[model samples]
Target: MPIKYIPYTPNTIEGQAVLDNITRTKRVLRYRENNEVYNRLERGMPYYEVETVEQVGKPSDNLVIRGECLSACAYLKEQGIKVDLVYIDPPFASGADYAKKVYIRRNPKLAEKIKAAETEMDIEGIKAFEETMYGDIWQKEDFLNWMYENLQAIKSIMSENASIYMHLDWHIGHYVKILMDEVFGENNFVNEIIWAYRSGGASKKASIARKHDCIYFYCNNPDTFEINTIKERQYLDKKFIGTLVDENGRFYVDTILTDTLMGVIHRVLDDGSIKNYSCRPVLNVSKERLDYSTQKPEGLVDLLLEIASNKDMVVADFFGGSGVTAKVANELGRKFIHCDIGINSIQTVRDRLVAEKANFTVKEVKDGVNLFRNPQQTMDKLSTLITGLQTKVEGVSNFWLGAINDSKLGSVPVYVPELIDSQQKLLDIPTINRIINQEIQNLSITAKKVIVYYIDIDDEKELKKFIKENNATTTDIELRDLKNLLHETVVNDELEFSVSKEKEEYSISIDKFISDRLKQKINEFNDKGNLQAINKGKKFDPINISEEGLELIELISLDCKNSEGEWFSSTEIKIDKLGYVIYDGEKSKDFWNGKITSKEKPLRIKVRNISGDESIVSVE
Candidate 1:
């Protein structure tokens, strides 16, 4: 009996495994204000924004709403924004620095400590704290857990046929792969691409310095996504020895044969000599063939984009650290949404987009607006707004919703109102005429400042008549002599930097909170150790503190531990201007050598033995 190759189907028992691979979550953060969501939509109102904000009676698009990602995902689902592709490059537990001089917090308490350390260190306060607190200890598990929580939200928002590319490195690549298998179903697992790159720097002391990272590709269901193929640069094993041409206009080693115990014979072809053998179950082709890079190349992104099919497909990146996937989507004319908790990652995306001259519209506003606030209030306000306009306008544009019948805002999709075109005779009515006339007046007034688009015109006469009837007076309105104006559409990509600046204000506040907390913690440690008084005469060198160490302190209180992996009793050690160390008896010995001494250099104090030797060694 011959074995038949069966195509993988997502509907089968095996297929169900893929869909069931997603992780489940119980609780997600909810916001205190609905006004934030509302205000955000209003403030950043685009002339013709993307599908996310292009719903009926949406609030402001100007707000930067941060809440439970799961909740936001729920709203997106309600909006009918089903993602087709998701690429998450979330935290890999590499302790890679994130954001503006801060590392992601593994321990909430440690996060609190780093915040406390920020004040006394001044400009170097946060740095100082990280050096003291997290200098030695690296928390790999906490980072992974934090990342997984966010990924749960990402997974929930994807379509059944969607694909995900989770980028990782050696740091925690293997662990994440296991997690992906568990979440995305083992059968749904696709390829593990090793993205190789060449670096100028050589790895001298170590075994082959790593120059590549792992990108795991998985689908919600097996064989449900688009696969893009590329042409090989050249043919493999060109056995075109002696004018060997086939009907297909290609050359091949026409003689490759072998015989098996089943009485099957096979032939093999060599350049000048013939080779044949008899085997149990004979095989014919023995030539090794190569087409392109066995490993997926960097161009993999372009190929994936081509397979996506839909022009306005939703492409999400929850682990959007470098943002290559998003950038590729944008370049390929696909709409993308990306997010990362890391400030540096977000900044990287922003910079790359801008540098590529990718078109984007952004608006910023203050935080108090509460855009993604109470979901109920948003629904109520939207109801009132839509109701008030129902009798006033003719036909609501469905450009944003495409064919989706339902889309939610807050937790409810905008109620799609039945639309009817205003009758020609209705233009004669004063009340109806007044609204039309007002719109025309507003259009005429703003035409010079912005592009004026006219739609639904068969000829010049209709255009002129419509304009005259509505009292629209604008030099920019091209009186359509043809039917093309009927299909007129307009979009805008203007940036309001002021809105961005205002949005930055809230982030700055968050930053300050982190700063204040770090400083406070540092002060507490200093006071407990009685190092504050000694600081009066001591000159501190900035270089002694490592950037990573300070980050750890800011993230968590720099709780120092001893050589035995035990928390050391807290005490104060003071340094004089001449770099003299003073501690209460053995307390000073704990930091410096066994005795208090003066030195010109800043003492290197190791904390927790996370990195080098010593829990907290002071060097001068």
Candidate 2:
């Protein structure tokens, strides 16, 4: 299938941007294939070691990764893991934010507090209770660029007979089809399956209602692609009631039947004949619906899986929204890999697979580890730690103020060393010296002392000589060890909680919860100058040693099964203004009650904050 070309004038800004991004994508792909090298196994490095969550039979068969799809796919390619089938339900560039509706358990005290805060809670107030799951809002040019990069990364890990199904809607499907042709080649293009379904309210503004999503299927090699002929059973009881039986004792519909039975063949030995199945949208709610907005039915995924790949073949879904693809693949006994960027997505998929007793390993992959070391990762960690400390600190911002050269210490200019000269290769010295020169020149005009943070100072003599030679008599330079700062920050930043048991019920009291990531977000909101958001962020204290802190918790799920096994949702405690959990046949309960007898096996508990961050605690 040939891709339809859309004309664009290069003089226009949007057109120029799109063209530029396409050129850049080609260059990036080339550079990555030629220059980038990675270490497959690095201890203590993020994204290397796969954490064993629950082992069923073997650890490597089923996997769930929490990370960006592009990097995770790249890592998979590095590990020499090839997949037979890939189905991605990527963002549709719909220019809207998606949120999940979370219900909280309510008690009389919370109800009274709600009443005291407002006379009556309205629909908007209820909406305020919802948690933002993921955002699909993106500019057209940016969205296309993102999709192109991800597709390039994903294509590298596809096997020779692999087939990919890209699920999308009317929004950007056409544009993506053209991009896919560029990446996967036009000759490999297969089918454009239209999944039609009906749900929700219809828009009266448009004459025609948008009721279907488009799924573009492509293959690595069209001639050698793996495919199975799936058949749908045509009921013969209703149509062949008065039909004659053949010599083989089977009901026969004449081969010369009407054109309606075009592709169906007349068989002799069976009660019913089978015909090639047609694609249909999943209209009815499936039993696997977890209220995820972009969730697809397992039947739909099953059909795709059955047609494109066989049992025991490897399958992967990079945009694992609700993990329907993984769940369906698990049921069909296929090895699978599922990856997603959202924390809530990981939690939802983890809980779903655990409840189904599916064994899988979880891993977290983040950028910053390369063949050559980069200071950005360590600097980012330090920034978070510094911003999270609640006590008085010198010139600490709630957000990461970029690197030392570009960042500031309050109103004063600051220069942060890019690397420790002693620990790295000699090739990096010239670059370090250039950066030092730039920093010295920038700090020459300021009266404030320049503070440089470093992990080691093996080149201290040389650095001191350079500073002394460049000093203008008015400026002073101060050096601080990065390790000491990390230690100080770690000592102050800690989470406190206590647990008590009463027979089968367990109660957990959180003393405090502090996170630099949350603080950084609040600071970013404050930077945007949103007074309302800033106020809310300031009062955003979620965990404390009181019942009011419990109100901030969205869900607390317990796993009373084998602690070493997959975490099954044995009990859940949710808190909402008007919601309640039945306890001993009584509603409006505050504490969690687990039906567990022995805590000797170790208990696992997952606590989710309002912002969708999940913290798993193991109790022995």
Candidate 3:
């Protein structure tokens, strides 16, 4: 008997999680209005300047929003956008950091060398550096607080009849299951469809290798909601598994009855065993592989979409990793919205959908603060930019993000909200009180003062007056606006390219490229030989840049008709990991020549480097 109920309900604690937790009745947190989500929304939900208006085969209303999903959902809710079906593979809170293997583009000499030799087909040979997409590290309390708000944000834009499938592993699924129950109500719970993967490997030394992921399904309206019956897919010869159809003319498979997800979910059930599902992980050689670590298989999403939605319905995935949901939805004739905060994710999904001729508008979320890439990068950069902020706070709890060593005050505790989270940006009486009396009350009494960084304040005067009246803690407190400490830390890499005309063909040759940041990262990596365990004693190979930095270019696109505003790539070329040029819609086995010819008269051109930093030049 699997224990579906935990005696200790996850979020049931009355002020058990955090003072700023969200419940069904209380959706908003303490002055969370100060968070960037509300701050951006208050600006009249301004449409993030359009990055692209991609129209491939047919005109589609699909969207790829490049920003935090919570903020994007807020914008969608404000814009009157309603989604009928949603599937989000959000962070599992597994305390693991996922990184993408960054490959350096090959120089022309190496390209020629590889093309000349038949054996040089390995693309992983070009592992330049690893770029972390996002860190899933979180404090359990903060995680719950953030998730409660995230669910509320997502629920705001969902239609009355909308259904949501939340994909998570055993790590924190059980806890969030309780959350879903509270947010969507236990009555709307449809099914816990377990996505059991094909691969299964458990270890005796460690715990069983949990291979399956749990997908909790919920609907806004149970009375009207209906899940379409999906049968085993037809074979190449168009034969069903059972070769049988019911009176309603729907195919059915008699042998496969279990709707389960045992292959990957690692936790032991009450019976001390796990179940399995039929879904398989996307293999590297499969066409579904998008080179994104967090990318899900199309088969999995396809099954879910078919079950939960009708054709041409509005589908959405807030935590859209590599755009699998959007891609599968587009293929199935459904309008889609793919939202992710990573630039790489946005670009990858755009290319994937564009190849299929899917239409979508790419929009950027205007996070006025934090000029850095994403939350993880922003936090990491803050660790260095903040002068006296100490990183080592092992003894202190998560409430105190870090300790600032002040010469006058000694070790002053700092309470900086994780910028990646949309939950804890605002500062008000409740939040200030929590910081002073509740959470940080446990801070070391020896600390002379505490520093709190807030993105927004409900009312600074009111808050200060309240704090002055209610300062019960022994240590003094100081409030600092998180935005004030932020300075532009992003490096703008230079580019050199030329355009020439040859009759109908306008040849755009990228002569050189430079990314001082990538070069610096490589130097730091080589200097601080902190290689993974597998390469403990091996000699580390240093990435050498040629005088002409043409090797840095990974992708090139041309917008022939438009020079500004919205961009639609009429012609484009991409350098795959194998160092081969995928020109327009075709991939050539021959190596790249560092020059591409476009038929459309080039108005503005965009070039993306191997590190995923894009720079554009207008054709004069």
Scored against the true structure, residue 240 in model 1 reaches a CA lDDT of 46
lDDT of each: 0.36, 0.55, 0.72
Q: How do the residues 1-620 of candidate 2 rate in per-residue lDDT, one tens digit apiece? A: 00111111111112111334443232221111245532211111112333344343345568888666655765676567888899999889997767676543333354566656755433333322344565676667668866776676677778889989999988899888887877787778888876666553265885578777888899989888757754443335433555655455655444422212122233222345443323333333444556677777766777778768888999999989789888888888898899976656776776677656677877765322211111323344456554322322234322113323224442333334332111121112232343344444443244344455554353667877766664544546666555555554322222456677777656665555554444444455445445555767754323122333443355566676756545555555554334433321234533333222223333776666645555677765
Q: Write the per-residue lDDT of candidate 1 for residues 389-489, one digit (tens) a residue.
A: 22122222221111112123111111121111101101122222222334334331222211122222224455446546654444223321111221121
Estimate TM-scores for all models.
Answer: 0.35, 0.57, 0.81
Decide which is better by TM-score, 2 or 3: 3
Cand. 2 TM to true fold: 0.57
Write down the TM-score for model 3. Answer: 0.81
**Decreasing lDDT order of the candidates:** 3, 2, 1
- Each candidate's clash count: 96, 7, 15
Q: In angstroms, how far off is 330's CA in candidate 1?
A: 1.4
On lDDT, the stronger of 1 and 2 is 2
Q: What's model 1's overall lDDT?
A: 0.36
Return model 2's CA RMSD, one decimal.
12.3
